[model samples]
Target: MSDNLAINGGPKAITLKQEEALRWPILTEEDEQAVLSVMRRNETSLSEEPMKLEKEFAEYLGADYALAEINGTAALYAALFVLGIGPGDEVISPSYTYWASAMPAATLGAKVIFCEVYPDSLDLDVEDFKKKITPKTKAVIPVHLWGVPCEMDEIINIARNNNIAVIEDACHAHGAEYKGRKTGTLGDFGIFSFQASKNLPGGEGGMLITNNRDHLYKATTLGHYRRAAGLPEEYSKYQHTCLGFKHRMSPLHAAITRVQLKTLDEKNSIRKNNIEKLLKAIEELPGFHIYWPPPHINRVYYENDVVYRGEETGIPIERLIETLKAEGAIVRRDRYPLLHQQPYFIERGSNPEDLPVTREINEHVMALPTFPGDDGRLVEQYIGAFIKAARTF
Candidate 1:
C-alpha cells in the first residue's frame, strides 16, 4: 500500500511542527548546527559520526552500551530477537502505544500480548501484567507512556519472578526517572525513539541500550553487524549469529540526535513547566482532565499533537477534535486502539478484549502539544477554545 497517509506526510493541514521564537516548534539552533557540522565534514555511518553519538548517548543514559538503529521499531525488533523470542513465545506490552512498539515482536513470530494501563495514571497496570504472564512469556516491553515512568519497581519485580526478560519502551521518555533509576536502565534492556516528535528528536533514529555484555553482542550482531573484535574467529564461521536486519542509523540522524541529547535536560525542564501551566489552566474547567503527574512522578510532556481530554464530555471526541482543528489547534483522538483490536492482529487471531484498561484508555485519551519551542499562549488559546466548545456543544 502507499505510505501516503496525510498523517505520515502529504499536505498536512497543520504541518507536524509549529514555528515560534524564530525556531521550528521542536528544534533549536544547536540542533541544526550539529547536523550541518557533520555534513560539512562528510563524516557518515555508524563507524564514524554515529559511533560518537552512540557513545555520548550511552554515557548520558549511564548505560553500559548503546547501539544506534534506523528507528525505534527496528531497535525493538533487534532487542527482542536477541532475547530468543519467536513463534511460540509471548511478549507483553501496553495496548496504548503506537503499533510500531508491538509490531516488531509480532513480525518475529512472537505473540504480542496487550496489557492494560493503570486507570488513573495511565501507566502500565502491574497487577494485570502479573496475571497475564505464562510459561510462554519470554519478555515484557513496558512503555513509559508520554514521559510518565510506569511503576518500574513493581513491574521489574514481577518480570524477575517470572524469569521473563524486560525491555522498556522508553520512546516517550528521555530524561524520565523512577525511584532514582533512569527508565532505560531499570530493565534488562531498553530502547528509545528519537523520531521527530520524541523528547530527543532526531528526525528518525533510535537507541538500544543494556548493561549486559551478552545482550550487547547479540543486539549488535542482529542489527547488521559483521564480525568484530570481541568474538572469537569461530563465531564468524556461521552465516549470521541470529536473524538480522539492516537497522543501523545514518550518521546524519545520529549527529543531530547527539546535539539534541546534550540539550535534553534543559528542554525537558521547559516541557515540565509547560505541562504544569497547561494542567493548571484546564484542571477546573468542566469536561476536561490533564491526567496530571502523580506525587512520585516528576516528568510529564505534550505532543504538539493536541488531544482533547474530554472524550466523555457527551461531545464525541471526533467532533470536538474537528472543532479544535477548525480553530487551528492540532487536536485529535488518542489513536492507541487495543492491539488486539487491529485488523492485522485479529486476522492473525489476537483478541480486542484481551486488555480491558488499555482499550478503555485508548478510546478516551488524547494528547496535546508540549514541544518546548511552541508558544505558551497557544496552549491557552486551545484550552479556552476547548472550554467554549465543551459548553456550546
Candidate 2:
C-alpha cells in the first residue's frame, strides 16, 4: 500500500508548506493603509481613532456602550473594578482557560476560585460553578474557550439567583453566537482582545462592551482618563487623574482593528468552514473525539484541538502525538497550563485536585493547526496522516 506509516522511515504524509496553510490574522495592503492613515495624522498615542473603534465595535456586537483598552488583561481588570470586586470578594472562573480570564480578579484583591469545565465542550461546567458559589462570591467569569461559547443562559440564571456579576471572557470568541446572540453581549460585561494572534488581529488592543451605563462610565474612568471630561458631572472631576491606570488603546491599533472588524464575519466563516471540513474527515476514527458546538451555538476557531481517549485506542496519548508528528503533522499537547496549579494561585490555597474533570480533559487534549488560510490540500494530508497513524498503532 502507498500508505506506509511515516514513522517507519516511509515518505511523510504531509508534503505541502504547512506555514502558509496555518498563517493567522491574514494581513493585507488595506491593513497597512489603515495604520498608515493613523500615522500620517500623528494620532498614535491618543486620538479619535480609539473612540471610533469603540462605537463601531459596540454597533457590531449590538452593545449599548464600548470602551477600548490597552489589552484584554487591562479590560478584564477594569471590568472587575467596575463590578466592585474588591478585597474579600470571590470570583469563580473555569480552570481550563487563559490566565487573563481569572488573574484580573486576584489583582483586585479578590479570591480567584477556579471551577471545572465540561469534558465534552471544554466550557464552564455550570454544576461545578454552582457548587463554588458562597456569600463571598461576587462575580463569575465564563470564558468562551477556543471560540466555543459557554452555557450562557444557565450561567446567567445562576448569577441572577446569586446576585453576582457575569463577565464573559470572549477573548477567544470573535463573532461567535449563542442562541442567536453574540458571545460578548450575553453577559453583564464582555471583553474581546485584538492581539496579533486573536481572531480579530489589531497588533494589540482590547474592547469592553456592556449595556450598563454606569459600568461603561466606570470602565472608561478606570483606563481612559482622557474621556473623563465628557463624562457625567460626578465623573468629570477626575479628568486629570482618573483612577490609577492608563489602559487606553493605541490609535494605530484601533485603526487596524477597525479594518479587521469590517471583514471579521467573512474571515470567521472561512475558519469555521475549514475546521468543519477537517472535523468531518476524522470524527469517525476511534478514540478521537472531535468537538462540535451545540445546534444553537455558532463557534469560531481561534485554535483547533481534539480530545484523545487513550483507553479506547489502547495507545498512550504521547505515543500517538509522536507518531502523528513523524508523519509531518503539526500536533502537540494543549498549551494552556491549569491556572489552579500555577504557583501564584497555589500559594493562595488553590488545590490542584479540586477540579478533577478539568485536569483529566487537559491530559488528553491535543492542539492542531487552525488552518486559517484555505488549504484543502493540507487538510487532506492531515486527515491521511491521522488515519495512517491510527492504523500503524
Candidate 3:
C-alpha cells in the first residue's frame, strides 16, 4: 500500500490527490479521540465544540468573529447574501480562480466582472482591477490563488477607496500571512474550506471570519437560527428572521476540524518546507519557473501547471493534456474560465466583451500538484515528464 502511486484511479478520486488522500488517511489517535469525545458525550450537532472552534479560530485569525458553515461554497454564497449582493450587482474577481469564486456572484443574479492577473505572479492586476471597478461593482474578491497572497493591502486599500467589500477566498490558505495579518483577517469577510486535502483537513466544512458586526449579524441570520448554540441570547428569540438559510456545520466535521486546527501551523510548515525543496530542485531545470516565495508570505501547497516556453507554442491545450497524462502526472489546466464563457451563463445571455487577459490565461495555464504524501520527488518526476511530454508535441 505504501508503494502505491500517490493518486487513486477511483472514479471519485479524479486527481492523483485521491491516491495521496488514501496514503494519509485520518486515523490519528488524537483525532480519533476528538471524534470519540464528541460521540461519547453523545451530542454531535454544533455544541460547545463549535463555539470553542470559532472562538479559537477568531483568536487564531485575529478577527472579532468566526462563523462555521456547511462548506466553502456555501460560506461564499452566505457572505454575499448576508452582505446584500443581489441582481444587477457586480463582483470583481481575478479570472484565474476556482469556479466557486465567480459562480457565487452569478448565482445571486449578480454580474461577474472579471479582471486579469499579473503574468509573473498570477495575482490580480491591481490597476486593471481598479479600472474594472464601477458603481455597480459591489465587491472585490482577491483570491489568494493557490495559497499565494495577492497584494491584499493594495486590494484592501483599493476596496476601501471604492467603498466596496472584500471577501478573501482563503480556502487554500490556512496559516498564511501578509504584513503580519492572517489571510482571513485581512479582508472584510474571509472564507476557508476544510476539504479533505487542505492543511486544515476536515473532510468537508467551511468557516467565515469577519470584524464587522453587521456582516456577522446578517451572516448568522442567514447561516443559522440563533438556537444553533454559541450565539448570544438576544439573537435566540428571533427565529427564521429575514429569510435565513440552513447552512450550519455538522458536529462530525466540526470535531475533526477542531482537531485539525490545532495542527494547522504544523501541517502548513511541512507543506512550505516541501514546496521550497521542490522549487529549488526544479528552478535549475531548463524551461522552469517557480511561483511565489518570499519572507512572511507563505503558501499552503496546491495545484500548479508547468508552462513550457518553446517552438510549437500554438499547440491547443487538449493535445498538451493528453501527452502529460500519458506520462502519468495528473495535470489540470487553469482551474477556472471566465463565467461569461461558461455555457450556462452564455446561454442565459450576458457576455461582456474585453476580457482579453482572462480569455488568454484560461486557455494557456495548467495547474501542478503540491499536496501531502508529497516530497519533491513527484515534482521532480513531473519536471522530466513535462519536458518529455512537450517534445511529443
Candidate 4:
C-alpha cells in the first residue's frame, strides 16, 4: 500500500506542464510597447507617466487623489507620516500579515501594537483590534490579507468612534470589493503595491489614495517633492525643499502598470473562476478547509492557501507536503512569519505566545499556485493529488 503513493515510487498524479499556467504578471506586447515608449521618450528619471498612472488609478477606485511611489513600503511610510504617526503614537496591525503592513509605523518612531487575525478568514480580528487600541492609538492598518477584504464596515466604524485613522493596506487586494465598494476607497487612506508578484504588477511600484485633501498634500510632500509645486498655496512653497524622500515611481513602471490596470478586472475574474473551480473539487476532502468569503465581499487571489487539519487527519504537515511534492504538485507551507514573533518585535517586548490563532494558521496552512491563466487540466490533477494524499494518510 505504501508503494501506491507517489512518494514511494508510484506514478505522479500531476503530469501537465504548469509553467505557463502559473506564470505571473502576464506581460504582453502592449506592456512591452508601453515600457519602450517611456524609454524612447527618455523619461526614466521623471515624467508625466506617473501622474497619468495616478490619475487613472484614482479614477479606477473612485478616489479623489492618488500618489504613485517607488514601492509599497514607501507608500505605507508616507501614509503613516501624513497621519502624524510619530513618537508616543501607537499603530495597530495584524500579526499574521506582511511586515510592511505594520513595520512602517515603527520606522516613524511610533509603537506598533500587533493584533490577532481571524483564523478562518486570515483578516484582522476586529475584536482583537478594538482591545488593542488606546489613547495613543493614532492609526489602525487593516490589511486585506491575500486579497480578502477585512471586516471593513465594522473596522471603519470602530476607528471612527475612537477617532483613529484607518489605513487600508490594499496591496494584495487590487480590484477586490467589500460590500460593492472597492478596497482602496473604504478607508481614511488606502495603499497598494505594484510589485512584480501583485495582481496588478508594475515590477516595483506603489500608490497611496485618499479623499482628504490635506492627507493627499502631506503624502505628496513626503515623497514627491516635484509634485508639491502644484499643491495648494500652503504647500506649494515647499516644492524646492520638500520632506527629502524621493519615492516617485519610474515612468517605465508606470507605463507597465497602466497597461496592466486596463485588464485587472478581467484577469481577476479568470483567477476567481479558476480558484472557485478548485475549491469546488476539493471542498469535501477530509481534514482540508478553504475560507470562502461571504456573498458581499468579492475577493481576489494573490496566493492560494488551503488549511490542513494535521491533528485531525493524524498526518504531519511536513509529510503531507512531501507527499504532494512527489505527486508533482507545487506545494509549500505558509509564507508569512508572524510579525510578533520576529526579533525586532521580540526586542520591543512583543510576546509571540499571545497570538495562538496566528501561530496555528502559520503552522497548518499550505500554499498552492494561483494559476493565472486557464489550466483546468492542471487544476484537476492537483485536486486528484490532494485527494490521493488525504486518502493515503
Candidate 5:
C-alpha cells in the first residue's frame, strides 16, 4: 500500500474534496452598501471614497500620508518618479520578485541590479545588497516576498548610510510587521497591491504611503489630480501643475477596499491560525520544513510554502509535487526564474553568475494553500494526503 506513489501510476492518496473559495475580497452586504452609497451620491469618479480610503489606510498604518493609484505598479512608478530616480541611476532589488517591482525603475532608464535572496526566507540578501550598492545607487527596493517582511532595520541603515532612498515592494505583504512596525511604513516609500490575489483585494488598485509630506505631495499630484488641487493656497482649480499621470483609484475600487480594511486584521488572524494548524500537522514528517520568520516579525502568508530535502528523502522535488497534487492537495513547485538569467534581462545585457543557493532552493520549494476561513477538516485532509504521499515516495 505504501508503494502507491501517485507519480508512479499507482492509486492516489485521498479523493479530491474542494471547498468553497473564500480567500480574497470576501465581500459582505457591507461592502456592497459602501459601493452603492458612493453611486447614489452621484460621486462616481472623483469622490470621497478614494480620499477616505487614503485617510483610513494612513491611520491604519500610522503613516503621515497615503495616495491611492490604479495598481501597485503605478504606485511604485510614482514613487520612483517623485524621488527623481531615472537615467543612469542604479536600483538594487531581489531577483525572486515579480517583474513589476524592478521593471518600473528600468522603464525610467535606471539600471536595475538584481541581488540574491536568502534561501529560506526568500527575502533580500543583506550581504549581496551591500555589495551591489555603488556611487550611482539612487534607491533600493526590497520586496516582502510571500508576505514575509524583509530585514528592514539593516536595509534602512544601509540605505541611509549610502544616502539612497528605500522603496519597499510590499505588494505581497499588507499586514506584515517587522520589529513591531508595519512593512510599508518601514522604508522611505512603501507600495501595496489590491489586485484580486493580494491580501487586500479590490479587484485592481494600490496605495503609496510615506512619512514625508514633500514626497507625499509629489506622489499625490502625479496620480491624484483633483485632490492635490484642493490643498490650501496651492493653486486655483482646473490649473494643472507638475507633469502627472492618470493613476487615480476609482471610487468603486476604493469603496470595496475600505470595507476590506475593516476586516483585514480579522482575516489575517484566520490565515495565521490556519497556517499554524497546517504546520503542526506536518511537523513530524521527514525532509519537510517550513520557513519561520523571526520572533519579532509577524507575517501574513499569501502562499504557504514548504521546502523538501530531496537528498534526504531520496526523491526528486518535482516527483513529490506531482504526488501531492494527485492526493488532491493544491500544491505546486514554487519556481520563480532568476530575473538576471531570463531572456529579457539577457537581451538587455545582464550577467548571470553564481547564485547557487537561490537556484537550489527555488528548485526544491513547493507552496500549499492557506487562505482565510480554512477549517479543521480541510487541514486534516491536506496533512493526511501530504503524509501519505511523502511516506510512499
Candidate 6:
C-alpha cells in the first residue's frame, strides 16, 4: 500500500473523465418533451396534467388512489390530518432518518416518539417500536431509508394488534418492493418525495398513495378541495364544502413526473447493478462491510450507505471520508442528526436517550452517490478510491 496520502500531494484515485456529478433528475429528451408539451398548450396549471400524472402514478404503483402535494412534508401532514392524528396523539418513527418523518407529527401537536433503527436495514427496530407504543400512539411512520424496505410484515402485525395506523415514509424507496408487494401500498398510507435529489425527480413534489377508499376520500378533501369526494347535492358545482389546505401539485411538476415515472424501473436497474458491482469489489476488504437486503426486498438505490468498522480498521470514519474525497470520490457525512437529539426536538422536551443504536449507526455511516447510469469507468474509479482509502485507514 502507498504510504503517502492523496491529501499530501499523492496521486488521486478517481482519474476517469466523467461528464456530470452523480445526482438526481437524470433527465433526457423525453423528460424535456413531456414538460414542453404541457407548457406549449398554456395549460401549466388547473389542467389535466396533474390529474393525468396522478392516474399514471397510481397505476404505476398498482395503488387504488394517488394524490399530489407541494412536497413530501405536505403529504405527511395531509396523511396525519386525514387519519385524525393530532394533539395528544403519539407518532412513532425511527431516529436514523431525515427529520421530515417526525416533523409532521411535531407540527400536528402530536408527541413524536423516536425509536431505534436496525443498523443493517436502517429501518425501525420492531422491538424498540413495540416498547414505544401506548394508548396515545395513533400512528407509526416506518421510514424506508436509502431505498431499503423496512420489515413491513412485523411492523404491520404490531400496528394491527395495537390498532395503530401504519404509514410508510417511502421518500427514498420509489420502485422498491417488500415480500413481492410494492412498499407504499403495504401501509394505510404512504408518502413519497420527488424532490430534486430523489430517484424519480420531479424537482419538488410529493405523492400520497393508499388502498383505502375512505382514506382516499378524506385525503382528497383534506388538502385537495378540487378533488374532494362526495360533495353534497345541495352544494353548487366547484363549491368547496370542507376545510382543507392548499397543498395541490402544479401541472408542470406533474407533467415532468409522469415522464420520470416511466423511466424509473430502468433507472433503478442501472443503479442496482452499479452498486452491486461496486460492493462486490470492496465489501470483503477488512473493516469494510455492506448490508445486503433480504430476498423479499427489491430495493431501488437512491443513496449508497457504506459502513466502516472503525474498531477493526483502527481508523476514524472522518479520516476515511477525507481520504476518499482527496482521492476524488464524492462523499460526505450523514446530514441529519439522530432525531431524538435534534435541537428542534430537544427544545420540545424530547428524550435523547430514546435511540442508542441510531447514535452509533450515524457515527460510522458514510453517504455515497448512487445516481442512475453512473459511468462504469467512474464507478471503477470510485471502487479504487474506496479500496485505497480503506487500506490507509
Predicted candidate 4 versus true structure: per-residue lDDT over 1-393, tens digit per residue:
233679888988888888899899899999999999989999888799999999999999989999999999999999999988899999999988889998899989998998888888899999999999899999999999999999999999999999999999999999999999999899999999999999999999999999999999998887778889999978888899888699989899999999999999999988888878888777787778889999999999988888888787888888999999999989899858788999999999899788887887888788888878865778888888888888876
lDDT of 1 by residue, 70-99 (tens): 898888888888888889999988777788
Compared with the true structure, model 4 gives a TM-score of: 0.98
Candidate 2 local Cα displacement, residue 32, angstroms: 0.8
Question: Candidate 1 vs candidate 3: which has greater lDDT?
Answer: 1
CA shift at 127, candidate 6, in angstroms? 0.6
* lDDT by residue (tens digit), candidate 5, 68-100: 899999999999998898888999988788899
Instruction: Rank all candidate structures by their TM-score, best first, as comma-separated numbers.
Output: 2, 4, 6, 5, 1, 3
> Model 1 segments beyond 4 Å from truth?
1-18, 21-25, 226-243, 302-314, 390-393
Q: What is the C-alpha lDDT of each candidate?
A: 0.73, 0.89, 0.72, 0.90, 0.83, 0.83
- Backbone clash pairs for candidate 5 read none
Q: For each candidate, how many residue pairs have backbone atoms clashing (under 3 Å)?
A: 3, 0, 8, 0, 0, 0
Instruction: Give the TM-score comparing model 5 with the true structure, all chains together.
Output: 0.93
All candidates: CA RMSD (Å) = 6.6, 1.1, 5.5, 1.5, 2.3, 2.1
Evaluation by TM-score, superior candidate among 4 and 6: 4
Q: How well does candidate 1 score on lDDT at residue 74?
A: 88
TM-scores of the models, in the order given: 0.86, 0.98, 0.82, 0.98, 0.93, 0.94
lDDT of 2 by residue, 72-99 (tens): 9999999999988899999999888988
Count of backbone collisions in candidate 3: 8
Among these predictions, the greatest lDDT belongs to 4
Model 3, residue 334: distance off in Å is 4.4
Candidate 3: segments with Cα more than 4 A from true spot? 1-27, 228-237, 240-242, 293-296, 310-335, 348-353, 375-393
Query: What global local distance difference test value does model 2 have?
Result: 0.89
Better of 3 and 4 by lDDT: 4
The whole-model C-alpha lDDT of candidate 4 against the native structure comes to 0.90
